[model samples]
Target chain A: MNSVIHEKYTVAQDDFANAGKASSHIKEHLKEIGVDPQVLRRIAVACYESEINLIIHAYGGDINMDVFDDGSIQLVFKDKGPGIDDIEKAMTPGFSTASEKARSMGFGAGMGLPNIKRVSDEFDIQSSPEGTTITLLFRESK
Target chain B: MKLHELFNELNWDNLTPDVSLDKDVEGVYCGDLLSWVMGNGLPNQVWITVQGHMNIIAVAGLREFSCIVIADNASIEDTVLQKATEEGIPVFASHLPVFESAKLLIEKGV
Candidate 1:
């Protein structure tokens, strides 16, 4: 939570059938709130990556979007799933654990997490056996 | 062709026609996978797939697709339908497989 607007989205897992719904809504809401277009696109892209990660990699999760008084956005996605064993390997550009069906659906490209980090001004990912939490921050003007 | 006309030809719901339906649709691409569609689809191409979700609509929006046809007689959830309305992305449903519908739209020069 921050001084600016905050919205929380509940993400469902393996619900491959309904994934990406929340990310789309959040992006639309950001647009309505007058967020900048380039920043909006970056946010939209990151939101989608993180949201899909929740669906494909975890059982379930929650996304928290925080707008700070500093004209920055913080997107936090937390999921209940098996934690990553090697952060370095996961950070590689082309590594993935996505299922065959997920691959057929056009995901598991190993670009999801990397893209999220690339677009954000600050990105942090912490994983444990219990769950994984990802925090992404984007500066609106920088 | 006006998208609604295409709908009439298919005998399906109005789905989604951009506010500018009079504009001609350039081409079509059909796939349920995100990677292939992103890599292969051209602008203004109609995409037909069995995947029914809001992500489909979002991809259409992100890529500026002409319209999305849901094949295999899949119906869109209300949330996705609402997102379509907001994004001005047309949506459709058909009983044909993705490839078959792609063929149908191609025959129509869609």
Candidate 2:
């Protein structure tokens, strides 16, 4: 099946007030489209973690979601400059350089990327001084 | 157990009165880290946390948590409560700490 739906959402840096709005809207859209519950949950987690990462770390970013007729999902998260210095280090759980404000909001536990990678069936990442991009894929069935 | 039943059993204050309380709680997850909870919290689990903020409501909704128990009597801002109610996530306040709140849920076989 071919891709049936495409959506794009912009995320602002340090926009804690509206942090999860994009992810929530994506989840609702997937649910309405009758995506598998388990796959939907994984997509929700990955999408939300990506959104929070954009808000907490990036200067700003865009989240693009594509849903295929077979129920598979593709999420691409792209952020502006000031990208990750060490992808390996940032991938390590419990390693974080989040600011004090993010910590006070009960975030910055350093588990966002790892968790997103764990739930995603296929994950690809590329980072440089220009920006960072993470692409994640979730299959409807194992 | 159902959320209303647990709320009554714990005698906690209902912060989001407009939200429904008939949801079933299958488990208990106690964590204050929003990312950790978002990644690990299971559906229908009642989350016990000391951090009562607007983001907490978002996490609860994303994770499909049954409800949130703000343990240790944490003061939840009016805006946070309003958000929770608007999102249809029930919020409860408990005098017991996080561990104690989890213990009670365990005792109840949640």
Candidate 3:
């Protein structure tokens, strides 16, 4: 089946007040479209973690969501600059570079990227001094 | 059990009166780490935490948690309460600590 929905959301760096707005909106939209509850939960976790990463770590970023007719969802997160130094270490749980402000808000447990990968069926990431991009795929059956 | 039943039994302060407490409490998850809870907290579970901030509401809403119980008498800012109300997630204040709160819920067969 073809893609039924495509949406783009821009996130600003250190925008604590508006953090999670994009992911929340995406969850609501997917829910209203009658996405399966379990699959919706996975998407929610992955999307939210990605959103937080953009706000806390990236200069700024955009989250692009594509929902297909076959109940598969793809999310692409692209950030501006100051990319990760080591993807392998970043992928490890309990390894974080989040600021103290983010930790005070009950985040920065070093679980964001690992959790995103845990819930995603297909995950790919690339980083450099220019920026970082993370693509995630979630299918209802898988 | 439902959220209203647990709230009444625990005698906690209802911070968001406009929101409904009729949702089912399928389980209980006690965590202060927003990211940890985001990944581990189950949907419809009553989330118990001491971290009372606007971001907690976002986590609850995203995880589809039934309600939030701010344990240990943690002070919640008006902004956080307002956002929880706006998000339609019931927020409650508990005098009990996190452990006790979770224990009570387990005893109640939540």
Candidate 4:
């Protein structure tokens, strides 16, 4: 039997108050499933970064997590609004599009995507004027 | 050094009676950026920064810092202070610049 584990979170723009709750819950779920600590930390970090990106940059969006039967997890983050115009520049280590309010909140450090990339085994970002979507994959360490 | 030592060394004039410098500081982190601190900070470290925003207070709480020192005579809004005080997180202020306070704290072994 194939089992698909699913989780979803609604992210809002500049909602620092609720930021990281999604990642915290995701980490907890992974922990309950006996995911490796190191891998769990990495996944949680990426999940948090993505969730914050949606809240800080995107008008709004949803982040979802899916665990497949084969011991792998995939994260999908989708946002709608003025999408990132230049993926190249956006992915750079110190680039940020965060508002002043977001910066004041300790986000907009310009490390969001880079941090996400660092944590996930495979990462992909697709954006346009209409929306942006980030897909991340982490393989279980056997 | 223990928190009480830093309290004495820094010569903080007013630590709320309810707030206690009651723990040992493992190290110190100085950054205004929240993500950078979260990414780099180890729990139990003292966070030294000029920010007095509610978000800063919240970050320290989530990160479980030893205590937070607002530098260069900076003080957070009353709301932030109230929240911090309620969380059992000590808040201190100094007229010294961040670099100077950081040096003093490190020199004093806090």
True contacts kept of each: 0.24, 0.78, 0.82, 0.31
Q: In model 3, which residue pairs have backbone atoms overlapping below 3 Å?
A: none
| DockQ scores for all predicted structures | 0.25, 0.85, 0.86, 0.33
What is candidate 2's CAPRI-style docking category based on DockQ?
Answer: high
Compose the digit string of candidate 4's lDDT tens values, residues B28-62: 99998877776666667989888877666556654
Worst 10 residues of 2 chain B by lDDT: B3-12
RMSD of each: 5.0, 1.1, 1.2, 3.7
TM-score of each: 0.69, 0.97, 0.96, 0.76
In the range B1-110, model 3's lDDT, one tens digit per residue, is 78888777777889899998889889989999999999899989999999987788889999889999999999999998999988899998889999998898888778
lDDT of 2 at B37: 90
* lDDT winner between candidates 1 and 2: 2
Task: Point out where model 2 deviates above 4 Å.
Answer: none
Over A1-142, each residue of candidate 4 has an lDDT whose tens digit, in order, gives: 2438998888887787667777767877888999877777677667777877888888889988898898889999999877998998988878888888787666788888887887789999999989999999898862
Candidate of highest DockQ: 3
* Residue-wise C-alpha lDDT for candidate 3, range A1-142, written one tens digit per residue: 6888999999999998888899999999999988888888999999999999999999999999999887789999999979999999999999999999999988889999999999999999999989999999999866
Candidate chain B TM-scores, in order: 0.84, 0.95, 0.95, 0.90
Docking band of candidate 4: acceptable
What would the per-residue lDDT of candidate 1 be over residues A28-102, giving only the tens digit for each residue?
Answer: 888888898778767777787788888888888999998888778889999997888887888887788889978
